[model samples]
Target: MSMLSVLTSFAKRDFALAYRQRAELMQPLMFFVMVITLFPLAIGPSPEILQRVSGAVVWVAAILSLLLGMERMFRDDFMDGTLEQYTLSTTPLYAIVLVKVAVHWVVHIVPLLVLSPLLALFLNMSLPMYVALIATLLLGTPVISLIGAIGVALTVGLQRSGVLVALLLIPLFIPLLIFATSAIDSASLQLPYGFQLGIMAALALFTLAAAPAAIAYSLRVSQN
Candidate 1:
């Protein structure tokens, strides 16, 4: 089979597996909603306050939710020995890593994106802010997935590596969180946020170019 066929097969297999494990897949989305909902109760339902912090609150929830699901990105395949086969296969490991991460980002992030507008209303976000939030997430979430995949790949062989993966990744994610929130914050103020969005786009492009190879290497090292 050709490389394209191999990668497409990998994508289909992962998507089917994700469908079979729907409950496990929904955990992150539930966590994301819970986090956003709790903020109002904790902070006493002030529109100004909620609007001011909405970006940070949503971005933080998103990062945490993504991390909650990151551990399983490779563990299932690792345990089933499928990951080992991929590493040993003639099809390139980086391509497999890219497909896996792309599917994961879709499976986890799309639900969150769908729910974001409602959550934005819950947080008293203006239309401009909501638009910025979507823009930032579109550009930023993949960077989170790509970078988070590296941490997950490195720790997948270990028992109970969830905390370790978060510890390793949270610091890396801070820059993304800052840029995303800053973009939303600027929108709230009726200011242009292209600078912040530009930085996020650059980060996404850099990670997209660099992360697959790094994750492929990490998986090989972890499985050794």
Candidate 2:
């Protein structure tokens, strides 16, 4: 089969398996909603304050929500020998790794993306802020998965690597979080947010180019 076919099949398989574990798949989305919902109660429902902090709230919640599932990104595949089989296959490991990250992103991030508008509503975000927020998320969340995949791959075999993965990833995720929230903040002021958006796009592209090889290598080293 061609590489495209292999990637598509692998993504579908992973997605199907993730769907079978419906409760686990729901955790990140639930966390994302709860955090967004609870923020106003904790901070009080002042529209002015909500508008000012909305971007930061969404971006922070997104990072934490994605982290909730990072541990599972490669653990099942590694534990069941699926990862070993892929590593040994003639297919390029980078393509396989990319597909795996993409699957995880879709499974974990899509629900959050769908619910973001409601969160925006809860935060009383302006239309422009909402637009920029969605734009950043569209460009940012996959980058999180792509970069987080490397950390997850590195620790997949460990007894308890969840916190370790978070530590390894939070620093790597800072630039993205900054760019994303900055874009939304700019939008709130009727300013052009394209610069921040462009930077985020560039970061996403860079991660796409670099992360698959890194993840593949990390997986190999971790399995050693």
Candidate 3:
């Protein structure tokens, strides 16, 4: 098969497997919603306060939700020998990693995006705030998946690498979190957030270009 065919096949297989494990897949979405729900309860139903902090709340929930699913990204493949097969295949590992991360990002982030409107309503966000939130998420969530893939690949062989992955990844995520929240905050005040959005898009592009190679290297080293 051609490289595009191989990439598509791998992505479809991963999506099928993810569907079969739908319960596991829903955990992140559940956690994301519950966190957003709890914030109002904990902080009281003040529109002013909720709107003020909603961007940070959403961004944090997204990061944690993405983290919750990161472990499964490579664990099943590693255990079932699929990861090693990818390593040995004539197809470039970079393409394989790209497909895997893309599928993983779609599976995990789409639900969060679907739920964001409800979250915005609950938080009493302004229209601008909502748009900015969605924009940041669109550009940022994939970065989470790409960067998280590297951490997951690094620790795929370890029995309990969740904590290590979090440790390695959360720091990397701080800059994204800051940028996302800052954009939303600026939007809440009716200021231009295009600068922050551009920075986030640049970060996402850089990750898109660099992370596949890093993930492929990590997977190979872990398997050896």
Candidate 4:
């Protein structure tokens, strides 16, 4: 079978998991909405305040939402003994994980991108800034999702794994968070955000190349 065919089947498994646990998929979406709604209450109703904080808030929410949903990418399969089966399958385990990670990004991160504009309004962001934020998210979030999958896969079957996962991920996530929020901040100043997007897009590409083999190796070692 072609790599595309194997990837499709693995991605379908992700979709099936999404279908079965509808609420799990909803958690990140709900978290985003709830977090955006709370900003006004906590910080008062100033447009300036909202504008000042919105970029960081959006990235923060994006990161947390990804964190919340990451475990589902592999932990359920690990629990059901399917992860081992995947390791033993004819297709390369890393290739299988690569597809699942991509699907996981679609499940968790894409909705965050779709909903970013709505959240941006609560921050009192202007149309230009809102557009920039959305653009940065489109270019940047795949890195977060892919890197977070590595953290998730590392601790997939461990008890009380939350703290460790965050620890593992924070170093990787910092660069993305910084540059993404910087892009939105640049938009606020009416500066060119294109440079930041370039940096973010590069970061995404780098993680795409590196994370799968790292995760595949981790899972294989865990099984030993």
Cα TM-score of candidate 3 = 0.99
Per-candidate TM-score against the hidden true structure: 0.99, 0.98, 0.99, 0.95
lDDT of 2 by residue, 1-224 (tens): 67788788888899789989989988888998999999999999899999999999999999998999889988988889998899899888989988888888888878887888888999999999999998999999989999999999989889899999999999999999888988998999999989998999999999999999999999999989
Question: Which ten residues in a row are the worst by lDDT in model 1?
Answer: 1-10
Runs of candidate 2 exceeding 4 Å displacement = none
Tens-digit lDDT track for model 3 on 39-133? 99999988999999999999999999899989999999999998889999999998899998999988998888888999899889999999999
Tell me model 3's lDDT, rounded to 2 decimals: 0.93
Per-residue lDDT of 1-224 in model 4, one digit per residue for the tens?
78788789788877887988878789888988899889888999988888988988988887887787776778778888998899889898888988888888787777777777677777899887898888878877788778887788777768878788888888878888888889888899999988889998888888889989999988876667
lDDT of 4 at 115: 76
Ranking by lDDT: 1, 3, 2, 4
TM-score for candidate 1: 0.99
| Model 1 agreement with the true structure over 106-203: per-residue lDDT tens digits | 99999999999899999999999999999999999999999999999999999999999999999999999989999999999999999999999999
RMSD, every candidate, angstroms: 0.7, 0.9, 0.7, 1.3
Give the Å shift of residue 210 in candidate 1: 0.6
lDDT of each: 0.95, 0.90, 0.93, 0.83
